[model samples]
Target: MPQSSPRLIGVGGGKGGVGKSIVALTIARVLSDRGDEVVLADLDLGAANLHTYLGIHGRVPTLSDFIAGGMADLSPLLVDTPMPRVHLIAGGVGSLKTANPTFQSKMKLLRHISRLSADWVVLDLGAGVHYNTLDFFNAAHYRVVVTQPEAGAVLNAYGFIKSALLRRISRVFSKDKNLTKALEERVSTTRSRGLLTFCLTDRLSMSPILRGLMMNTGRD
Candidate 1:
């Protein structure tokens, strides 16, 4: 039997200079060392620099080509890295426009990503809570938030987690207007920084539907 889809691991944070790319690269290296084939994708969009960290220079086919309609499949863009068993899908030095791809384009890219022939895929996401960033982060089987040991970094990381969780909730309950509204109100009124944990484990657990959704989200 053939191998199933690769497990995607997304590394992201709200603030820049938090070493998200380094963390992502490290994860790929560790996994590859364990005898697993890993693909390190530079999903940082316009500000992609994962290639530099790997000492890869010169022009190369990147995710930009696929997003720009120049390529059909993400597999074709895979480039060998210095690390054994680790491949790379560069972010490309594209214009700012490429950073904000159309919804259709984003979906297509993600679909192609799921089909990549690797045991693991490590995504280095850009800073901020852009819809594309959040969606990509949420798409991953494992999500990691990188941050420095500073007040600002911790605050931004918290904000990113909040945004990603809210986006997930919105997607899960898109059809239920009442529940969505109630959740939104609950989130807005809760001033505590631990609001997400509280909602997931406390009050929201009172609803069977929400409990089920949370369980499904975890499995996804």
Candidate 2:
């Protein structure tokens, strides 16, 4: 069997109105300008406005169609932009029926995305640390979180990163009760639970389970 080529990307940030979408679209344009076949998926779920930046101004059929038992594959829903090597899985419509699919569903979408025949898949996500946005950002091999030098932007970016890392840690410690307690204590910043100490220490007494997770989550 032939090995499939890898094609995935993510551009996101914790700061609102920071022009991350514009950057993503412009990068897609450059990639398309170089004859790269690119598919931009607005993975922001609830607030997907990437199409507007690309000058697409009509009703867009989205993954909501397929997820809600629409008989068509995602292709018919690929919104065309003026860029030659670019196509889009627009996010302009939704159904209340199958609302807020699980994180597993998001992963399923990502798995299916890996099978698509494209040179690049650029994804633009919304601002925040919501599970959906974080999952989408972490799913790609190349993930970039845009941020300004402002304090609010930096703090929110820290919050977003903390949430993502803790979520992964929770997953690894999901089965170990004692480890979970230790995690809470370690992640906490109170006098009883010194997260600051952990941060300013040479080593944390994390369980093997948590150590493995920390390694995988880049917390080490």
Candidate 3:
């Protein structure tokens, strides 16, 4: 899972009307102007409007439509933007099935993403910490989390990071033989010490995570 492909950039702001998409579009334009082949992907599969700045209109082919058992091809859907070297992949408004695709569909989409030939793939995520946004953000190589100067925005941003970290850790450690066995054995048991400390010194003792690794395990 060591990434060795085109760099992927994702932009996500905590609250609505925080200029997240505007910043993404601007950055895409600047990079495109510099002759970088950038494909701005609208990961916001709910309400997407990045194409407006480029003078695109009407219903477009999108990720949702692809996930909803429809056909999609890069040549047919890579809409030309006003900026040179910059293309667009629009997202569809969500419904029941199109909003939350099945696991198989996600895997299929990811597999197809690797086939895209571009220097940069920029993902514009929707506001808030919904699963749709965070999952897409996690898929990117580098994440740009934006937040306003407000308590609520800060909390939401933190929550997004925490959720992403938790999911990543779960995926990484889920298949480890010792760690998985130990966690499953002790997940519901009262160990020698507190559950938190048990987690530190026993289940994932070798984990380099700042939380479990740095906690004082001497009490156990």
Candidate 4:
């Protein structure tokens, strides 16, 4: 049977202990309660603890299994949760190898996720601004950057957003060398002028397409 294209949602935090996993779990529960098939993927690779929040104890076949060639199909790895219609693809326990998956493996996992038979696929991304984390954030249809109401958390959240924006810019024009070069030059100029003063409008000024994308962000 053909699967419906799942709506991808990413809940991320710039720092640890910001309740990103909690938010992801809550969203998944809400969606599932509404009769939507939801798959919560704990993509917090290095320090995945979403399962703990979901109250899922014991062993589970994580993304590690797929990466290690132990599992071919991801569907079999979905673990049933207490919440009806909400499934989980745990990030697995321990094992740094699972944490630092190769670029190819990450891409493969993403492809497999896109085909999941779920109404929504919520990815609980790891903390920090690593490329791996940002890639998942950029791919999500709804990107939620969670942060506490503290000075450090606020600052880190801003930093994460900045990095994510930069990553998106590079990805959008990666194939066009000239455009990429031009963007780099613009970024340098912006930084030279006033790095602290840089804003979203300035970043979006380079490409109308990007500007349009920014405008449309968060719209269902």
How good is model 1 by TM-score? 0.85
Clashes of each: 0, 0, 0, 0
Candidate 4 lDDT for residue 90: 91
Model 4 weakest lDDT span, ten residues long: 210-219
Q: What lDDT score goes with residue 161 in model 1?
A: 80
Cα displacement (angstroms), candidate 1, residue 195, comes to 4.7
For candidate 2, report its TM-score: 0.74
Relative to the true structure, how large is the alpha-carbon lDDT of every model?
0.81, 0.66, 0.66, 0.79
Using all chains and alpha carbons, the TM-scores for the candidates as numbered come to 0.85, 0.74, 0.72, 0.81
Model 3 per-residue lDDT at 118: 79
lDDT of 4 by residue, 82-112 (tens): 9999999999567788888898988989999
Better of 2 and 4 by TM-score: 4
Question: Model 4 — TM-score against the truth?
Answer: 0.81
RMSD of each: 7.3, 8.6, 10.1, 6.4
Best by lDDT, which number? 1
Cα lDDT tens digits, model 3, 1-220, are 2233556777885677666787678667766776778889877766877877678888777776677665664545688887888889887764656566776876676566656777777888888767667767777766666666678876665556555554554556877868755654554354335433622343342324212222322123
Best by TM-score, which number? 1
**Least well predicted 10-residue stretch by lDDT in candidate 2:** 211-220
The TM-score obtained by model 3 is 0.72
